[model samples]
Target: QSIMMGGLIKKGSNNVESKIPLLGDIPGVGWLFKYGKKSNAKTELLVMITPYVIESDDVLAQYIKKFQEKTQGLRQGLGVKGSTAALSGKTDKPVPPGE
Candidate 1:
């Protein structure tokens, strides 16, 4: 099975400026007396996930073993002596209520 997700983000900004009406029109000093600003932004994100189906417990066990081997190699390459959970910022400790 597979899942697909997509998103779009849009952002905008507007600025209004004021200066001495007549003096701001002067050619050389106009820039120093007058100001205006505007901005526009957009972003897009796409994510896709595919899952494998295990036929039985044996197959699932084999898959787990292979996944562990790959992750172990990755950890070694990154010189991480800690568990994967540490990298993921997860711990087995229970959280207290309202904390």
Candidate 2:
């Protein structure tokens, strides 16, 4: 069995302002001659996964055996006990080159 984990974090901020020459600096009228905006944002993400390794042919064979055993009942129920080629539109024998 193997384990993997990952994470990411991001944070940012931005400020924007626009104004006319001298009218933007005026006392009360400054609001009409200038526009300003500020913003802040943060984001985070995390991920984890675990997997099993079949290191040898023996191990691989064992997994295959288990899968076949588990699916045998389903196959029997579906009446599909023989080769799957017919269902998949394939032929058991190879075809010759261009007729």
Candidate 3:
């Protein structure tokens, strides 16, 4: 997200810039422009405000249900202690003891 946000700043301005976000108000991370007449002049700003968000739904909603069903069926059909336990502990295999 840093790369994305930083790219926005690069495209927006060519003045002094800071790599950090939300710290644009800090000393040198960004620029502060001033213009006007007389001693007590007015100040202007072109601060960069970044936006971000979390996007997590397609992977979960799209495949989670299929993964659960396939895993459960493999356990029950094999009857190797099912999925709830270890297959090595199953005492019902047709082979003789250690054979």
Candidate 4:
């Protein structure tokens, strides 16, 4: 059995504004000569964890083999290059050079 947990945290933001010195003080038409700018920043953090128990090495090996078999043709018919080699069920190790 496996358990998955996830969490997300968000932080609030700050807003700022600015304008021309004297011209900005006037009301109504004064807006024409004033430039205002506001900036808001937000931060978020996400965490996810999965926990599982395996009794022994044999059990782990069995899981790995099963995964390999299940995904044997995962890349088939995707128009990928060298697909024949991918279907060879050689997921556990890299092929040595010079054959």
Candidate 5:
């Protein structure tokens, strides 16, 4: 299990794109694989990344469900593994640029 730098975005924009070293070098889904030399032994890595923390429980729950619904039965993986989400609460204010 590992937690490394993954995605970053601003405000309530559901569409935030980023380019990371090595990751952006690959094409399509191939971008998921960032390294070589996967040993023949058993290994596991469960990444935990909180994309953006918001202030609305309803939105948070909605996004969490979206993540859960998408990652179902994705078994093929390499040295890379991960999932992402936005955590929000009711009291937070939305940024003007993201509006």
Candidate 6:
């Protein structure tokens, strides 16, 4: 089976302000004499992903074993049981009440 996923991420915004030199800086009457302009620019990111599912347990196990062997050097402190749990789609932490 093949699964397709897509997402949009908005990163940042831009703001701009404009004012007359002498009139804009006035405290109370700044609105009438001076003008302030603000504009916002945002960055949009698109993420597309496709994942192929392994149907057979033996194939899945082989892939998991290969992954474990590759990552063994990097995962010195973490336990093998935790990795196995994640591979089996089992989380050690209990789910929250609402979620």
Residue pairs in candidate 6 whose N, alpha carbon or C atoms collide under 3 angstroms:
none
lDDT of each residue in 1-99, candidate 5, tens digit only: 345655543333233335567766777864564434322333344446656766897776887777655553342233324333222233354434312
Highest TM-score: give the candidate number: 2
Q: lDDT for every model?
A: 0.69, 0.71, 0.45, 0.58, 0.49, 0.62
Q: Give the per-residue lDDT digits (tens) of candidate 6, residues 2-97.
A: 343555756554555567777877899776765556555566565655465789988888877787676764565554322433554567776444
Candidate 2 clashing pairs?
A: none
Worst 10 residues of 5 by lDDT: 82-91
lDDT by residue (1-99, candidate 3, tens digit) is: 233323222223234333445544567634443222323334344445544452676554445456557767886687644332222344464544322
Over 4 Å off, model 3? 1-55, 81-99
Q: At residue 43, what lDDT does model 6 achieve?
A: 65
lDDT of 2 by residue, 64-91 (tens): 6666566666777887654323322346
Query: What is the alpha-carbon lDDT for the whole of candidate 4?
Result: 0.58
For candidate 4, list the clashing residue pairs, or say none: none
Supply the global lDDT for candidate 6.
0.62
Flag the better candidate by TM-score, 3 or 5. Answer: 5
lDDT tens string, model 4, 1-99? 334465566666555556677877788877877666656666655565555578997776776676555555563444333323323455576645422
User: TM-scores for all candidates?
Assistant: 0.37, 0.39, 0.24, 0.35, 0.26, 0.32
Residues 1-99, candidate 1, lDDT per residue (tens digit)? Answer: 779866566666667777779889999888788877766666666687779987997786677667767888988898766443332335576544422
- Give me the candidate number with maximum lDDT: 2
| Residue 4 alpha-carbon offset, candidate 3, angstroms | 33
Task: For residue 38, give model 5's deviation from the true position in Å.
Answer: 17
For model 1, the stretches where C-alpha displacement exceeds 4 angstroms are: 1-48, 84-99
